[model samples]
Target: MADIAVSTRGLVKIYSNTVKALDGVSINVNHGEIFAVLGPNGAGKTTLMRILTTQLRPTSGEAYVLGYNVVSDGDKVRRFIGYVPQEFSVWTDLSGYENLLIYAKIYGVPRHEINERINEVLRFMDLSDASKRLVRTYSGGMIRRLEIATALLIEPEILFLDEPTIGLDPAARKMVWDKLTALNKELGLTIFFNSHYMDEVEMYADRLVILNKGKVVVEGAADELKRSVGGEVVELTVDDMSKTVHRVNEMNSLGIRDVNIDNDRGIVRVIVDNAEEALPVIITTLRDAGVRIIKASISRPTLDDVFLKYVGGKISEEGRLQEVRTLRSVIKKG
Candidate 1:
């Protein structure tokens, strides 16, 4: 536990005595790592961030950040962490320099060192040229970077970002991530963020936790999580849908246990230990059974597949809707 930057045990949060926002959630985030918290909307991702950031308290259980208890030592925790919420936290009317200056003073930076630190952060965020411009004139990505720059004024050891790139275009998102990466590498900052974007997590996160229904369904390095789902995925396109389904079911007898059929798309997804060996048998069986094989391909498991395997559903807008409905039903029954 000495190297752990954040830790929680039996964390639980309930609202209005009916809804359980966090249910026995527990996790460990190691020091100096980019750790990601991922879940569908309303999956307690933000709730966990709030608790750890000392903005909200859990109904029960304990949490610690940077060796300080979040609840009992909130002041100390605030000193060691910087938080960037999903929404912009900057003053639109203020120039970027003034914004940083205000936050630096609020953080109690030495008066003589205030301008020095502000200029350092502005250059670090690549906003030095635009620092004099009013934030209202900045682009979406520029605004995000300014927010991050403000958070850095205190030189926090651990930075918390909630959906940092939610609405930015691809280029803008990349720019934000690039600044984060630089901070992590150059300054040894620990980054803890919650993101709905799987690609970002896969690319930048050193480790991650997937929470569902207020519980940690899975936690590990992205590569390890993907491997846990099994090996390569074999997607088969067949002419006869029903026949293909029947043939795929027969594969169960051959110890191919994970097969999914999408009748609407005329495709069967098979999870196999070794695609090279399994592909031959699969094709032979389908052909012999008079099922026309139109195409077949093998691919490595993606983060989406890993999410589906554990979450038991696709990770999409519709999936979040379903989760909300399920939560409401449970609350009503309770």
Candidate 2:
């Protein structure tokens, strides 16, 4: 337990009307590693983070941070952890420096050291140049960095971020992750963040758990999880997806493990023991059936594939439409 930064067992949170935000979640986050919680919105990612950060209490089960129980040692837990909630946290009316100062005060940073801490975090987050600019005037990425800067003012051992890069552009998202990677390497800070971005999780997370309907679906290293799906994928876009699927099923020698259809894209993604052996057979079978293949490619399974295998569908953007709007508003000013 000494080396473990965060741990939870059988954690549960129930809202009014018997909505279970989290159900029997248990996980361990090692010190000095980047961990990710991934799921579609309302999957209880925020609930679990809130419980560990002491922002909300679990109805049952246990959660600990830095060897201290979150319930019994909320203050101690708060001292050792920095949290950036999913909603907008900074005051858009205020300059970035003023925003940090307010948080430094709220977090009880000593008066004498507050300025130095603010400067340090601003520099670390690469927001020193925009320190005097109003948050409303900054780009979406700048505001996000400032929020992270505020979280760091306390110099916590672990950082908890809820969808830290949710609505940023590709370059902006990469920049944010670059900063986080540096934080983990340079400060040995444990980072636990929730995201719906499969590619980001695949690239950055040392380990991750996928939650669905308030329960953990699967957890492990991304590559290991992908391999667990047990096959390469031969993805095809055909004029008649239904016909292609029907044709593929008749080829028993291909040893196809599973077939997933993206009806929206007219794609049939087949998991097979060997794409090299199965591709030719699948193509010929489809051609003989008069199913026109518009596109086809063979590639190793990805985190998305792993997600589909476990969660039974692709990740959805159902609950994040508002966040997207807010991000657009912030970016419009810049």
What are the TM-scores, per candidate, against the unseen true structure?
A: 0.89, 0.89
Clashing residue pairs in candidate 2 are none
Q: Model 2, range 1-334, lDDT digits (tens) per residue?
A: 3889999999989865256678899998888889999998778898899999998889999999999999999988888888898889999999999999999999999999999999999999999999998899999988888999999998989999999998899999999999999999989889999998999999999999999867899989998999898679999988988787777877777788888786555689999999998888888888888988888999899998898788866443432454445445666655
Mind giving the per-residue lDDT tens digits that candidate 1 earns over 1-334?
3699999999999876666789999999998899999887888899999999999989999999988999999999999899999987999999999999999988999999999999999999999999999999999999999999989988899999999999999999999999999899988899999987899999999999998878899999999998887888888988876777677777764546477664445677787778877898889999889888889998778787688778755444465677577678877877
- Candidate 1 accuracy as lDDT: 0.88
Inter-residue clash pairs, candidate 1: none
Candidate 2 lands at a TM-score of 0.89
- Residue 157's lDDT within candidate 2 is 94
Looking at model 1, report the run of 10 residues with the lowest lDDT sum: 311-320
Candidate 2: what lDDT?
A: 0.88
